[model samples]
Target: MMRSSPFLRGTALAVSLVLSAPAMAGGYAKSPPAQQSNEESRHRTLTNSPSYVPIAALTATVQANHRARGLLQIEAGLEVPDAQLRRRVERYMPRLRNAWVTALSVYAGVNYRYGDIPDADRIAEVLQEATDMTLGEEGAQILIGMIIIHGD
Candidate 1:
């Protein structure tokens, strides 16, 4: 029988240790790369993207009219008698729809002229306010329904 040299035995052991250590851990380990900055992402998003100006402008206008309608509903509810209020509300339905549509149209035209969409945050704010005004309010339900029916 031949005896193995001590140096060869030690070298074999070292190689086995290195390979076995990784296998024991189950796989290679590494941290993911850090996220890109917001500014960098925004710049990428805006670059070469087609303008949505008309849609944005229309969204703003519709939102504004939505708010106006809510206010008018509340005011009418408080001021007018129930029977008369219903009639008045019915009468104003056409006007309210027209107002919303007109707002959207004007904004769309402006956006077209400018060749860039306006930010929708302002319009969104107004619409949110209008939505808040309608919730839990008595006469607002009918008015909101009317606005939806006429506007749609």
Candidate 2:
């Protein structure tokens, strides 16, 4: 009879244990998790710890009709630390929106092609720049709520 090495036996045991872990835990259930209420979801997302000021929804027309492809719509908000800065942001909303539109339009015209999804982070950065330039300050954080690209 040949004796198996202790190291080999230990390795095999470890592998078996790892493989059987899920079975030991009674396996997976068929049903998914219970859904939370819309109000609860919103409350979780919108925390009292930060001041969130709404930005007007913006629609950017990407490249001209390649069958209405590349049209982008963005809805966002700004999180400013204080009420005063929030007010300032509100006052400069028009300028900020214009800057964002110009930047996003140019970006889409150059970078967006057919069947391509726009990068939300990149667009958020662009919006942040516009906000900072308009406010003459840098603490505002851009929270993008929605980015819809109408592409075929």
Return the top candidate by lDDT: 2
Candidate 2 structure quality by residue, lDDT tens digits, 15-112: 99999988876645433344335433553343354588765667777765554565788877778888888778778888888888987787687766
Cα distance off (Å), candidate 1, residue 6: 99
Which candidate gets the maximum TM-score versus the true structure? 2
Question: Each candidate: RMSD to true structure?
Answer: 19.0, 15.7
Clashing pairs in 2: none
lDDT per residue as tens, model 1, 1-152: 99999999999999999989977666446333333454334322212323211111112222233332111111111122355544554555555444444543554444322323343543333433442343323342211111111121
User: What's model 1's overall lDDT?
Assistant: 0.36
Candidate 2: lDDT over CA atoms? 0.76
lDDT over C-alpha atoms for residue 70 of model 2? 53
